[model samples]
Target: MKTPLLQFTDNGIYCKKANVYLDPWKPVDHAIISHGHADHSRYGHKKYITHHRNVPIIQHRLGEINVTGKEWGETFDVNNVKFSLHPAGHILGSSQIRVEYKGEGKTSILFGYSLGKAQRLLKYLNTDIGEIYTHGAIENMTEVLRPLVDFPKTTLITRETKKEQLLGNIVLAPPSAHGSTWIRKMVPYVTASASGWMTFRGARRRRAIDKGFVLSDHCDWGGLLESIEATGADKIICTHGYTDIFSKYLREQGYDARTEATQYGEEETEAALASKSTASV
Candidate 1:
């Protein structure tokens, strides 16, 4: 079955396949959100679907929108297209999206952000530009030009050299086995990865950061490729990344892949876009 050609936009559609909105940032009549992140979940909606635990968060954000909570593995149909939510791992209630078209019976493309370490599992580094000189580096002009950075290489090395230095063991929680996994034993899945804003507070907790596993909120190059391979997908639509490099890499691997440059945010829809052009003229 031909997977409905997915058009990358704030709101998504598959004419023959049930429409699936990855994460509705704009005001939509009906919506399904992957998580409660401010960028993903926004105001205005008649009904919204999300994780059961996120109902409160949704309510707080969207006010009176009818919030529907979905458990992992449950399927719902929207205009004949079947979509199911799976754990995304970016946050407590994040999900990776899977959609199927009833007409084709072929599994539609799987939209995954690829999982990352939990919010609490990592501490980010924070260095202020102003502090570089204020902390006595002002004495030497040459020293001011030099950059200073702190990475947790020592802690990682220590953990590898001495097991006692390891505060906690790293455990890889395999993706859901039966439904999402192809083999049911071990198949890789992309978790929603995000880059966090570093703060001075996080810099103070460098020890904690060192002890935790470092991962991204969006899929890295390797993880993106792995997700594509795991799905056994014939064609891939890459977005939200350095698409040129990723698409080139995918093509090198003999996969029919293309990169999609989506908009900055929902603020730029077709109608809104047309209006901007008119206003500019």
Candidate 2:
């Protein structure tokens, strides 16, 4: 059998042709990261490549490091393989890394975290969509990112603000504020959550959300199937999240599908822990 262009390895998704890894957890010579999320983008690489907008974010998180920033859709070559970064729409600097070798292309989260998801919501949303209001936490985080991203105007919720002012506005807040007295001012509001989990049946109800938008940084099941079909890839590898079940279903559909173990899914936990630490401070 021919060696696949991309292979699952101890380090991460590796491309032997390019001698590089994608979002490797273990240290490697060169790593092409998809985003700045902790799980996807880690420290200890000799060289790093990611979307240009992400440079500040990773630099802030990882400290001084050798890194290169690439523009969306700008193709570069390493060895015989071609690579490019495409907007992932997950966060301000998030990207979907595309690797092409022998004319094949492959493509690969949540609003809960303030830094990434909150900014994404702010960027895409507009006054035409709805008046954007944000909790102080979200507002503060967004202000930090204002220099990096062009965000829509957002109003910070304040004690002086009247409930009537929020009547028809979209309020962006963390999950912790959902049932708190801080949210009482928005009592007449309809609760909505934007998350991949919203795709699950009854997820909205369980969260007491009056409306659920299947807006997520990650692909839903339907999106996964659509993306797979679009790729026309003979071999499919599932790295994380319902991997076994998803791979099995893919096999049942006659695709060469399999699962690979990876160190992912810890980003949310880390983000939650960080949030708690910040709250305590």
Candidate 3:
């Protein structure tokens, strides 16, 4: 039989054929990082490879590490293993690593922080629908990513924007801003929060928001199903929360699904993004 392409090692997910680790939980010799996040891309690793867009952010956090940048779809071979990077859409530079072993292929989604969700929202938005406003934190990301890629226009939500400007507007904000003082000025506006927690009715009701959008960067049930189907893999592995439940559900659907016991937390989120007034200071 052909050798396995990837396996869960003591340190993290290891690509045996490539001799590299993917988003390793501990320091390793070669780490193919997915994105720049405190937890996912931790400090200390021999060498790193990720998308070109993520290099700056990763460097900012890791500080002078050995890292190589590759544009989307760029491919390279290492020790008989072929690897390529593709946009994962969770954050800027977040990537899905595609590995080929013999004639079979598998992919790992490398997502840590999902500021990229903020990026996707701008792609499909109907600006004609209404004016778009963002909490200062979101606006800052927009400023960083706007020039790198195409995104919709958004105005920062400020004390000066005036209440009248928010009428029938769409505002992207952090979960903490849901009940904060900044939005008191926009009273009577429809309030909605985006989070994976919104999958629970209790989470939504507890927040007291008018609506909750399940706009998490991490894959949901439907998204996982779609991704798995698209991969055309005969078997599936569940790495994180609800793994057993999700795996069972997938098995019931007739696609082979199994849960992999791994120590990975839920994808980190900027759920508590604060306003510019505070972020600036």
Candidate 4:
């Protein structure tokens, strides 16, 4: 049997090959964090390796620490193990870490309390998803936060943007904009939302969205299945929501699956962004 590459302990999952822990709950010499979320990117690590764009937010939240940020595709060497950070699709620099050592490999993705949820919401949007337009509130807040974080490329739905332009686009706006007068102006377009909540057709129906994508920062059932298949990892670790059930399901499917304890979970959204209103129909 292949020796376990990463083992879960009280401190968190330890990568024996790298001599470092991933999102370690307690302080350690070297901690390779996946993102800036508080639960996943905790304080007290002697050194941290995360994505370059995440530096400011992590620094702002964690204060003084030996943190080294790297570009998404860059590889960093540690104890003969190769580590690479990739976008988690959460925030400016929220990342998923991929590690390779001695012919073995694994990765970890993090998502928790932090800003840029709005931006993460945008990455999943496209022509296939839909073209992009946003609420004045989300756009305005993005403008204010853009200097601080790298939000997804977006356009504000203003008077200048002809109504014809909105025909084939997805509007990344606040919940309040749903069925509001402003949306009436942009006819011939359907509405949708991206979240784990939409995993069920009933939820999607209740949401009344013409379409709903399971585009959660957190993985959905299908996402979990798809990720496991895509990674082809022999062993699987469940750390987030519905851990026990998912872990059991993985085990039934013939995977080395187990649940671990971690306080990290879903986070709050920007209620303040909903405060502003757009032009009326």
Candidate 5:
């Protein structure tokens, strides 16, 4: 058997050719992070690399770490392997890292968390989609990121703002606002949530959401399959999320699929904490 270009280790995803880790949980010499989320971009790494927009985010969280930022699609060499960051459309500075040694492989919107998800929606969404309105919380975070990101014009909701102004406009708010009195102001509005959990049947109904966008920072079932197929790799590794079942299905399909244990949170815990924080706001 050939040595795999990437290996799942106790820490995170390891690339033997580069002698570096991707989103390692434990301390390592060098780590190529995917995003600023605590689980993905942890502290204690000697050196860090991520999207340029994420430089300040991790810095703010980790406090004084040696890190380098890279632009999307800018390939850099590590040992003999090539690596690049591509927009994942997850959060403000979120990215998907692309790794290649020999040759290979290839690689949405509306009311979300103010910090990461809101910025993502703002960056990609446009007036062409709909007139954008934001709660004060979302607006405040967007203001801080204006220097690093290009966002569509978003009117901040205020007492003086007429309900008529919100008509035909998409409003972005924290999840806490979903069933709160604040949202009641938008009478006759349709409620929706963008979350990975939406993949489950009745997720929207459970949350009382009128519509579920099925948008997530993480990959969904279809996304995982599409991504795997695009990689042109016969080997499939599942680190989290129904790993056994997913890998089993992949094997049934004739791919070399397996799972690895990881310390990364599946986002349920993080989502709970975020919910609490936003609920207080």
Candidate 6:
């Protein structure tokens, strides 16, 4: 039972023995994507699986291929491995993957991007399962807060405050084809929510400033700890945030969790180039 070896540059998890690639967007044979974000979706793949709704976007970009789409909770079989797409609550067609190896008799759930607050745009996907119900009562204002629960599942943004305040609910969903619009909107929200622990949600796997969602697409600092407690995954590998803070929080929770921070010296260069190119366009 080994945690998958994830490559930092590509954010691709490759099983050398199985020869399977998870979320490989750079022209791989099989690219199992968590969402339709450009960084997660790519062309020149022999076959792949993604959210059912994202099929339109993927096909529109990648043309023809062996494309398999899955709805939430539906397990699909590929190469003798059974995996199900769970709602990550990042965008319209966002999903977290739950992989079950029938042969190995193992069940593991990976949150491609999970959120605790249910947004208005995607309230239909709210589910009462897990700690969401437990934490729903933390603040009376958050009673209506439902995130990634159930269809059109996406991320939710709450205005944090040191002194209790009623700032109304703010939701952050993917505005355009890519996550640029969402990230743009996230800047303001992050500034607003900086008082408390801010979770930079959608841009987890990508190594760029504008490549993903800027909303709290996953459980926030508190949410992360709580969800980790509920799911009880043997080993927790947290990527995509301030390493020291996440590690400290995880350690205090009495879990065998650790941070995996990947360094990408050239990543910033690529981001700058992309930003410049987009500006020119």
Q: What is each predicted model's overall lDDT from 0 to 1? A: 0.46, 0.77, 0.71, 0.70, 0.78, 0.47
Residues 141-255, candidate 1, lDDT per residue (tens digit)?
A: 1122334432221111211233222112221111121132221221222222123212224531442222223333555556777888899999988775457877888899898
lDDT of 2: 0.77
Better model by lDDT, 3 or 5?
5
TM-score of each: 0.35, 0.45, 0.43, 0.38, 0.43, 0.36
For 1-281, candidate 3 gives per-residue lDDT tens digits of 86577899889999977789999999998998888887779888999998889999999988999999987767777887778787678988898887765532211111113266656766776554356777776777678887799888777766557666666567766555555666655665666556677797687678676666676767777888889889999988988887889889988999788988776655434554442334320
For candidate 4, write residues 48-140 as lDDT tens digits: 888878888889999998988888668778888878886678877887777767532111111111235556765444323235566776677
lDDT of 6 by residue, 1-281 (tens): 77543333453666443455777846777767788777778777788888899888778876887898878778666665666677787987888876645332211111111123323223432332211111111122123343423333322223232111212122322212124532342222221121112234533333322223233443466787788778978888866656677877777867677877566331123233233222210
User: After best superposition, candidate 5 residue 204: deviation in angstroms?
Assistant: 1.0
Task: Name the runs in model 5 displaced over 4 angstroms.
Answer: 1-109, 219-281
lDDT of 4 at 101: 77
Highest lDDT: which candidate? 5
Candidate 5: lDDT of 75?
Answer: 82
Evaluate residue 148 in candidate 2 and report its C-alpha lDDT on the 0 to 100 scale: 85
lDDT of 3: 0.71
Candidate maximizing TM-score: 2
Candidate 3 global TM-score: 0.43
Clashes of each: 10, 1, 0, 1, 0, 11
Q: Rank the candidates by TM-score, best first.
A: 2, 3, 5, 4, 6, 1
Error of 4 at 191 (Å): 1.6
Cα RMSD, each candidate: 23.6, 20.9, 21.1, 19.7, 20.7, 21.9
Clash number for candidate 4: 1
